[model samples]
Target: MSLPPSYLPAGGPDPDGAAAGKRTYGPDFLTALFQNPLDPGYSDAAARRATEGRRTGWRRGLAGGSSALTLVVIGFLLVVAYRQTVAEEPARTKARDSLIAQVQNRREGTERLRAQADRLGDEVAALRERALGGAAIAELKDLEAATGMAPVRGSGARIRLVDGPTSVDAVTGERRTDGLVKDTDLQLAANALWEAGAEAIMINGQRLTATSRIRQAGEAILVDIRPVASPYELTAIGPDELAEDFRAGYAGPYFETLQGRYGISFEAAEVKDVTLEAATEFKLRSAAPSIAPAPSGSASSSGPGSPAPGSSTEGGR
Candidate 1:
């Protein structure tokens, strides 16, 4: 039986009865895998190279030389970087040591100055007491004590706070700063002590006055521009109920939350014979007579002419 035109054998005439031609299979996955695995472009390139003969020796040498030059340049750059790092290490270390030494020297100088100032302050106080009357001296001493200008010793409460562990929450995938103590936290703690009727307070030995500032500069906490590091210790002089009152205040529950939720360390206790130092700075508003009183005969003429004490006469100007 004769086969149909469309079902002709391999290397047969086309189905449309055109000239006889080689039968071809499209380059699908199975055809490429079993019949011709090499890519057609690579096969063509190989045949072309064979017809043209091998590359000239100089060209081959040029390709190999280019690769070798690239490797050499990369190796040189790596060596230079390593040597530069080694050479700069000592310089960096020396600069760090110099800065540390300067810091130590400045700190020692500051301490010496502070001691001298304290001695001068004591001398001034003694001279002032000798110049003023007994009543005036008593009033001045009371004022100084109340205004945190003079150190005092008494029963009081001590509060300590410290930073908690730094960690990311496993479930929430959030890093919490609640564990860190901030300037605001100390401010709140101080305010709470004041609210609890504390007569005098000191934070890390720095007296807390009305004009004193508790603030943050970068990661460090500053009290009156002096950096105070953690585990912050706060001392408050007050009555017997100082600790109880502080714990009842808002700062108590606030600290409790920090301890429970954020792992912050907070502690408070009452103790006797707590001593707080005087503040180094104080701001006072004073008034003095701006003009001398008139003579007895000219008293009536001075009524309108004499300005009140402490009143500025430069208002209009």
Candidate 2:
């Protein structure tokens, strides 16, 4: 068919035609030719190349996305594994450190105790050697023989201040234990024995020392801070005359008077060779002989008497 001359494309320009701005197609003859259908052979090889290029590009894009996903999954797994290792490490370290500390402490304690035990063994052997040997016993036996009294041992009389006696006004029987042994009575007896030269005094099997203090427990009189129960039998080892004289001057009179007034029993057991052991002394935790360590970054001289040992330097009481 014959086409009009005006239908021919013209004025072809740059890749992005300047006149194409604001409008996709130009207002000229070229714009009218594209409105018609294209020939079937126009884009045979170019169309194939374009379709294959698109397929290849899509495949490359899919491969890149899969690689990125794999990397992310691996990173996540690595993070989880690292966290698990971190979590397990501290516990293992803690257990190891604790076991080490325990072993170290036990070793140190054992060493100290072994040293103390060896010292105690030596002390015990020396004490056994120094104990009243046959010679020492001879001196004591001679003294007793001259005094006309046989020396006794193995067992002796033990006095205990039990609860006081109950008194119903001595007639009412309403039960008033005020008549029972009192602290004053026990103290008087203990004082009499001490003044009479008691070698050893105890209450409830507890040895009374110089620092001992007597107290009351219920109706009973406790000697040397050790609670004892009933009929306190005090003993003294000395010249039988001194013991007798001391009691005749004090306890004898008191016991006789109290016995008659309260109808309480009074008895005595004279024996020799009474044995008493020393008390166990405990360390005081709160009391520090030396000043405590000062805070960090402080002057070495610190303040005078800064809680170090020998700070007090005071003479004994």
The Cα error of candidate 2 at residue 168, in Å, is 3.5
Error of 1 at 226 (Å): 1.4
TM-score for predicted model 1 compared with the true structure: 0.52
Residue range 1-317, candidate 1, lDDT tens digits: 76555456456655676644544444667866888777789988899889997777998899889999999999999999999999999999999999999999999999999999989989997898889978999998777777788888899899999988887889999886657887777877887787788888888988887567777686788888888988998898888998888888888888888788778799999989977878875665774665986777652311111222443322111
The global C-alpha lDDT for each of the candidates, from Candidate 1 onward, is: 0.78, 0.56
Q: In candidate 2, which residue ranges exceed 4 Å CA deviation?
A: 1-165, 169-174, 282-317
- Model 2 backbone overlap count: 12
Best by TM-score: 1
28-58: candidate 2 lDDT, tens digit per residue: 7566567745655667767876776644577
Each prediction's TM-score versus the true structure: 0.52, 0.39
- Backbone clash pairs for candidate 1 read none
